[model samples]
Target: MATAEKDGKIYCRFSRPKSLASMKVEEEDDPSGPTEITIDLSSGKVIFIAVGKTYNGGNDLAEHVEAPVLSSGKVDFSQFKVARGTTMTLLTQLHGVAMVLAWMLFVSFATVEGRYFREGFGSKMVCGLKLWFQMHRVVTMIAGILTAAGFILIFVKVKGLSKNAQAHTYIGIIVMAATCGQIFLGLIRPDATAGWRPKFNWAHRLLGKATHILAAADLILAFRLPMVSPEMRHFGTTVVAVWISVQVVWEVTFEVNKYLQSKSPKVDSIPGKEETKIEEKVIWKDPNGRLQLILCILFVLTIVSCSVATLCAILIF
Candidate 1:
């Protein structure tokens, strides 16, 4: 065993011998023996020196040794400066890309698909399911898969949860858990004609909306993290702002169109002829159906544009 004393503070090392046979312990610290060298003074402030092979296969699990402190009572970390202009790790890039695609692209696409494309694709069927249902389900599933993968990659890169418990970390975990829950809820959704279908639909919509909001917030937070470049943060924040504006416009347009449809006559006729009222619920085939389809296409196009821009910013900046 070797011990270091600096500025009247003592630091010690404890270790098991490499040999299987036991040896007699010495009363005094050995200066010539191996020791555990302390590399970081920022956290846990302890310093050590290697003595021999550790008890647990080479792992060092020794208790903290009293650290040497300056007269000001501060442990100086001036020697451990972070490297400037260091490139981000590959895992971090992959994690960011995956999350951007999941929330900025797939989630938004899925929401628009379910909200406005149902009537446009109401007549089309994919297998036994409606086209809108298939598209929404598939897109949402992809988002969930991407979210899970991104979460795992970041967790592995970080080697576990953050010790400081950052807000970004907490929000990310919440978004991931909620995304999984949303997928499960979708799978167990009641049939359209079931008695509880209304409740299910409302629950699903609300959960989806909440998850989407949180996911967006998390992405913004990620852009603002200390590791991210300032250029990326500015570009990402701008892209998100424009994307949100587009969403608001699309939603307002849809609501206005729906309101106008409700107030207008059910059927169109010659200008001089009496308009007829239909009793059947509106799905498609209305006079404004083509307009709704056009609106959906425009909304989707705008969303895709914003997502692509944000992705490019993430990759380049």
Candidate 2:
């Protein structure tokens, strides 16, 4: 032992001789793991070294220190182990962080998926949409926090991640990029462009579709791709998809029935009956203009925010 004994405690420190293998991950599968080193705390000596098969497959890349050569340079073989092992602490920390983050993003996606549209268009649904939108923001904030944190954590402990995690990262990166693209489309203004640019609405809507597609892909990668092991990704995806379908059904039904009911204002049909000014007697009872304005504002805000957030995440991380 290289460590010295303190007043009431015993400390053990050890160091290894120097070598080239300790500088990088020697694993056959994952080549990005950390290099091994010998640390002698009491003696205050740290040296680079390499060994046999490690838990991460790192050791297989290098040979252990054999007995010293015939001359003055003798190698130390006494401390060599046939199998190498990984540090449990680092692996645990990395997995814990990534898992937490992935789960958070999943939760956010789930929250906003099934409830917004159907409940957003009704007289009573005004409050419902408000509350749902509030929760949506909450979930979005949580996901952003988790994703940023997880990205850092995974980058640090990358070697320990299974292939699935690696795949998940790639898909996540794409989703992030799509999200940014979606946001970018919103910054356009027709007047500012001197008519040289494409329509902002079209670009924005297209990117939104892209973002939605990428989100689905992200869920798949995060769950089934490589090393990702989230238990709820599939279930959440199914639920969201089903909910979206139902919302579509409801929208179609509402629109078809509404169109049929609105067949009147039939003043247009009686064109030959002398152009009478019926407009003066028409009394509008529904004060829907104000509500329409509010809904429009909400839509615009949601688009701007979701786009900005997705873009920011992709750019920063």
Candidate 3:
């Protein structure tokens, strides 16, 4: 078996074996995909076959009916029998694709922006970070699947990791709790958005921050990083610092740019119908909309700041 570290921590075990029909028959099909892509431990050939459904066929690569949701482009027979060690590579693919899917679903569901654009990247991809909000529900559901799978695999299969298990377990629990809370918020968000938007937004943002923190913590705790005579806990701290710094820079840059853009003279000259204002006795007419925007910004900041804090707290602990 040939093993290669593809990314920083995620390693891939490769082999080249012919069709292993017996292994396929014996093993339970992986629920990740329609077909079960199995590896022959003796060699490393991945037979892109699938086991049948309850009332259907068996594990024959050729006889599989379901098409791969994530295609490997044109088939490359030469690059086969690859097994990834960590969940990073697979989760990256799943999360990336799922984000794209979530964007599409958002556009389909309630995209006033999607309708106006005819050319260029559709509102799905090109739209700003608010796109994240619109697609939150679908994206959460997809990310939920990947996160759950990863938790199960890591908890069950991680054999030798002992020092950081407690921290890792804590982070996993936070993410799971956050994910459930986020999903719940989204389900009631229709009514919630109308009345309790502020609270809902806070809960969602807090969970978002929790997810980022857990992810950063997990990255550091990987078995094979900073093997430079460093303690395992240092790795966790380093990941937290790096993740927070990067996120802060990305978010701040985005906001500064957006603020500058919105302030530009050209933006205000759009041919809209009327000005949003009212000369009442003392009350502002559009308080609700203003409140909504304020809550949105508040949540955004909450998530960013909390993510930064989660890592800092772990380090201090």
Q: Estimate each model's TM-score.
A: 0.65, 0.36, 0.38
Highest lDDT among the candidates is held by which one?
1
Candidate 2 lDDT over residue span 171-233, tens digit each? 666655654454354344355556655566466546554555555455444334322123233
Off by over 4 Å in 3: 1-134, 158-164, 223-244, 262-317
Better of 1 and 3 by TM-score: 1
- Each candidate: how many clashes? 6, 11, 3
Q: Cα RMSD (Å) per model?
A: 13.8, 13.9, 17.5
In model 3, what lDDT does residue 278 have?
Answer: 38
Q: Write the per-residue lDDT of candidate 3 for residues 1-317, one digit (tens) a residue.
A: 56566557655455545554332222235443344444344443323322234422544423223322233323445555433232232443343233222222221122211221111122445354335344544545665665665555555554435553556456556666676666677677755347768877677666665665565554444322322123334544554555456545645654453344332222233377555433324222332345434534554454445444433332222
Kindly list the per-residue Cα lDDT of model 1 for residues 146-264, writing each as its tens digit: 99999999999889997655688999999988988897898798888899999988888999999989988887787777545557778988898888778778777777766655643
